[model samples]
Target: MKKILFIDRDGTLIQEPDKEIPQVDSLEEMVFLPWVISSLNMFIKKWYKLIIVTNQDWLWTELNPRENYTNINNKMFEIFAWEGVTFSHIFECPHFESDNCKCRKPKVWILWDFLSENDIDYKNSYMVWDRDTDSEFAKNIWVWFYKVIYWDDKHNWWNILEFVAG
Candidate 1:
């Protein structure tokens, strides 16, 4: 059985900018939250496969071009690879909430599709996110879930890993 740790991008591992609609318009705006690097390394050493599931609905508009997202992901992957941490896959939904897309968080189609082709230990796999939609996605996929509250003093990724993976 293979264990996986699905993580949310914005507002979970990366710091969401102070905006009503949080977005990283450029690679320069891509800043990781505290303990992200250390926690990623810890999870990698623990032999957990890492996956990033995110909803970038804002990228559907011209305010944030698609290239920005690509550049951000590329730079992020490069940075993570330099630390010996790589994502098994990065799944994102570019459709807005109104689009009623099936791949978005709370739908679980992306995960379900992956599961249909992969041998995953769903009982041992977990999803770490910062929103209710993400938790719902985990529930829809029958996997464990953990919320990463950015403002909390004790909800860092390291602590979450200890509590959830224990």
Candidate 2:
């Protein structure tokens, strides 16, 4: 069985813009957090498969068009590739909170297939993210959870390494 690190995208992997609703709508808004690359590299060195599980609200709507999202997302992947960091899979829920989608965060419906097919080491696996919903997601999936404070300069995003090392 393989150990995995289920990470969030905005606010966790990259800097989430200070908007009414945080979303990486454009390339300029997709700034990466400090020490993120190194921390993720450390997890990789520990033989953990990195997977991105995120909730992107109103993704296909006119407010957050699909084309704009694709451009920024592609750029983020490109940058990560340049840094030698690659994710095993990226599962996204593009639905509004009112939509009550089964794939949204805190719900394991979307991951049911992946979980059944793959041999995952649940004990060693973890969900690293910056939201309460993410914590709930970890609980739903029966994996350990690590809450990361994105705005805290003290942590500086390097605290994630503690999970891999200790």
Candidate 3:
């Protein structure tokens, strides 16, 4: 079975700057956390295509309104491009919690979609999420789960990947 590692964007791979969820509508606020690059590459080296699945209802709406997540893709890619890092795939849920959408975390829609679109072997895939909601999504989807944490000791992506992947 082919394996894929699905990761969360904020608070996990990227440290939550400003003590809050990133309002990364623009590249000016886009910041890469320590070891994020190395951590991802390690999984890739292990034959796991890197994927990121996240929920950002705050993007399109405030006070529980779903916002357009359309801008996020380019912003994220630009950050990676500036840093020379790349990911294979990404999926997101833009609905607010009040929307109670099935596609959001703990719902498994993103994972299911990824599996169907990529023809991935579900049994061999894993997900890394920082919060329980995201983990729940991976669980509901029947994918293995890992917690993505940040350690100040992580200074670069190589070190981060070597430590996490091991």
| Per-prediction TM-score | 0.93, 0.94, 0.73
Choose the strongest candidate by lDDT: 2
Judged by lDDT relative to the true structure, which candidate is superior, 1 or 2?
Answer: 2
lDDT of 1: 0.84
Local accuracy by lDDT, each model: 0.84, 0.87, 0.66
RMSD values for the candidates in order, in angstroms, are 1.5, 1.3, 3.7
Where does candidate 3 clash, by residue pair? 35-156, 35-157, 38-157, 38-158, 38-161, 39-161, 60-67, 60-68, 61-67, 106-137
- Candidate 2 lDDT for residue 97: 87
Clash tally, candidates in order: 0, 0, 10
Tens-place lDDT digits, model 1, residues 1-166? 6788999999897888887778887777888877778788888888889999999886757976788788888898888789888888988888888989888888888777788888889888899988887888888878898888767868877778787665
Indicate whether candidate 2 or candidate 3 has the larger TM-score: 2
* Candidate 2 whole-model C-alpha lDDT, 0 to 1: 0.87
> What lDDT score goes with residue 142 in model 1?
81
Q: What order do candidates take by lDDT, descending?
A: 2, 1, 3
